[model samples]
Target: MGEERNRPTIVVVDDAAEVRALVRARLRLSDKLDVVGGAANGAEAVELVRQLRPTLVLLDVSMPVMDGLEALPLILEASPGTRVVMYSGFQEQGLAHRAMALGASAFLEKSMALDDLAEDLLAVLGADAPVAPTSPLETQHPAADDLDRSILREHLERFREVFEDAAIGMATVTLAGQIVRANRTLAALFELSVDDLVGVPFADFTAASATAVRAALADILAGRRRVVKIEHEIAGPAVPLQVRTTLAPVLDSNDRPLYLFLQMEDVTAQRGAEEELRRSEDRFRLLVETVEDYAIFMLSPEGLIESWNAGAQRTKGYTADEIIGQHFRVFYPPELQESQHPEHELVMALRDGHYEEEGWRVRKDGTQFWANVVITTVRNGDGRHVGFAKVTRDVSERRAMLQEREATSAALTAANARLQQVAEDQAHFLAVTAHELRTPVGVLGGTADTLAAHWADLEEDERDELLAGMSSSAGRLRRLLADLLTASRLQSSALQLDLAAVDVGAVVDTSVATAQRTHPGAAIIADTERDLVVQGDGQRLAQIVDNLVSNALAHGVPPVVASARRIGDEIEVAVSDAGPGVQPEMSERLFERFSTGRAAGGTGLGLYIVRQLARAHGGDATYRRPEGSEPGAFVVLLPHSPPNA
Candidate 1:
């Protein structure tokens, strides 16, 4: 008791309620120092300091009403013997110099560790300041004059303002979980007025977070943790709130557990934003993987493959696993590699920011195909060259289709003897085109008419089937028009790619579902892994897959299997049927426009479109005989992108 009286009484002042509470708790750790009071603003601090005339005052620079700089002189004048230490989170050189010029004993940064803060505080107070009495019985303290009693009363009054006016949820809870003192914010949290919350158990307010809060409190009391910060749902007055809670233990002068100080901050809005951002990323990733008309990939600065997207998998013959970390030169033909064309392309891209060319390139099977290659320089945030973005499209089928159209046009203009046959061919071609366009439209129109005419006579199941048929026909018409427009763009050399990340597996699933809807009788099985992402356009990739599946179902027998799988660095999707396979003689002309077998309904252009779409994505569509059987199989292979690339 005698030593407690002799200890040098100190006052802590900060704008932050938490900082003030922390200072009080920390100061009480040493028997030589006693925290008399705390103030939120400089105005209150000046009054408190004047009345208390303590040994030292820890003053924060930024405060409302009056700042530390403005109140420093007044504090000094009010108590000539008191020492003033200026503290803040800011590390401004001019502020530090000005604080010293204004008679501050020390300028300490608020970011200093607790141990450093204690050492700096003790150093600033000086060794000559009052020390604890050596013995308990020696109660005679000549250092404390009659003026100290007046100071004690002033300190108690200043503390009352801080305890009641803090904006955050603050409370002093007993070790037994009783709330001895709580501010307006804490009471407001539980929907009660401050006056009515005097003896309420802290656990009552902590409905959902009761267990967590009690455990944290116990840890603090047992000295296991210095501070506990956790996010918990608190039962507020009007509604439940997600809050960040902090608990700190207040120790007595003898280093024994005394009370608990809690701070709560509502963070419900922040958590919602985080969840929304995660969902947005998922949507964007889906968009990127659905592409299938262009090969999109990334390379390291040294021209090594870094990322391969779905379009790349479709266009290139490698999967993400097989291609990543390997040099991009793997896609070049032996002649190009020997001539160092790949290196030259990189050099050109680096110099010009981009390089584009159309030439022949080798696929994984060493088969040569015509491709349009575009390489663009990639840079880091600092504008330094990091790598390159490569986009490639296999234009072989498009070139072939255009060439055939031109040849047919030129033949009609010349060869007068064959002009009659040419006109007949033209008429037949137009008829086939009209039939393809009118079939789906007619189905849609007839279904609508039947439903309108027999509204009362049709059963629910029949009506549903008719409505589904109309929808299916409408979708089919839309797809056909899209294919024609794409073909027209290819003929005019106006086809362009809009590349992004796409989920290959999702695109395959959509295509398989569409097939099931269109051909309800066929047993269409889809076997694929989820999250097989690649760089491509979703609509185009779906078109390619749908075309192949439709072709297999129309030309082959039942039990069609559509399977997609990752093969090394590439992705392969195969649609297999159990019907008669492609004749060996027609293998060379199978993908040619106007080259259909004895299929009853096609315009002879479906296979051509499928091949073109696959080629455009830097991939190829192939017709093969199923292993150990005469049945046919249609397959498309695409590339996959690396994770995080």
Candidate 2:
């Protein structure tokens, strides 16, 4: 218990559970240090330090939530006496310096042997406990000098075994470049026995690089370079092999160079792979440079253009010499450049591995064209981002053609819709015409049959009454037929006007009288200005008045009036009634064929015929409704003029 209390307590912290467990197990090997607790992250380590106040904290550098460097000061703040040693997998000197600057006592790599790691931790804690000796000579020799000799002999034997069994070729060469000793691996490299390789001049085997090798050896002997590495081809028994040789100086206690420690590795396969990669790159570059349809180029990581291919020159109208080394933003339009879209594209490519878009791009001559662009991040063999690969395709003509096709398609669609509407309207016209004809035809047929079958039996008054009814039905049929024929002629553009000096007032008066006879007991009147004259067809003029009066009587309240007046060079003929005028919503299409406002008892063609005939006489018809306490008027304006004058 006394010894345990005297030993320094440690807390192990790492993100990996297994790593923490391994460290705990390794630290147990040291009797001078005690593992008090464990943690998985820097935050937990900080809390553990505050609670335990251990003498030492083995903290991992990289961890989730909080890394060791961030927590180091906080841990020290929590327990000022506690020493933090940074344990990490990275061997970067910057990280080590940063950790030490942040108050870490030591930075130790995780790759160190478990025993070495334990000794390091013990050293950081300033533990005075000596390591237990492993050799049996320590027990046999108690004298200090004899014990030292035994330890030295043990070390020499271990070194000899390690040197003989090393994997790569290893040898010790004198300052004169003579091989003092060579390992089995080195002997096998030369296909000679270890005994025969000793005392041989090391430069004799390096015939291809003998002169360079001698100069490198001289540099090592003169203490110019601490380490020198060179590659040369060796003549092997089967074939020539590429070898990489490293010469590191072994210095004496006086800091002077003693001899060179040589290490060699066969790199024939690596050299072949490098050569093949170079050839493949050459082929790819040639292919890219010859492409004519697309611009392929390279950009440095900073977005500066590095390589421009032949296709790039052709598409962008700039030669390689003129564009290389410029920023890639030169290809973007002013608006996109202002928005930093070019730089944004690189950022997106680096984040998502690639970015693609189609938009306007600018050329060297300041012309703009639609182009499809793709930017891909280029990474080297180490998976480090070194630059970007950009591919651009000019598609201005194709885009223009597509837009034109879209416009044409829209026009055709609209035309087809209008045709379909017309077909539907025609069908409705036929249905309504058939319905309107059936009523009057049935009435006429019934009246004629009544007169024929009961002529002898009926009283005189009844017979006269039936005759009047038959006449009325026949007149209705005649008018309906006339309107239909007129409509058909108007639609076919075959209706011709007979120009004459027609009195608009006289026409209105005659039409009103006719309407009064047809609609007995209805109040109808015609008021017109004197001397209203126009050159037009008289019959068509009368027909227009008849249709308007008929529409008012059929669809309006009583007191229908047909009036004509002269306004400037035109005559305004108006028919109005005292009824809720044409509905505000339905008034626009009232002149359209078959648009009845869904009203019954009419063929739905009266207003349409009135407007068509009015316009045919170099005139137009419109509906006017006053705001309050007034009737709606269908007004027709016709140019008033004399024939040929």
TM-score of 1: 0.35
Local accuracy of candidate 2 as per-residue lDDT tens digits, 199-288: 988888886899999999888777687799989876543677789999887654365766778999888899999999999999998999
Query: Which residue pairs overlap in candidate 2's backbone?
Result: none
lDDT of each: 0.78, 0.85
- How does residue 358 of candidate 1 score in lDDT? 92
lDDT of 1 at 63: 84
| Residue 122's lDDT in candidate 2 | 75
lDDT of 2 at 494: 94
Can you give the lDDT of residue 311 in candidate 2?
83
* Consecutive 10-residue window with the lowest summed lDDT within model 1: 130-139
User: In terms of lDDT, which candidate is strongest?
Assistant: 2
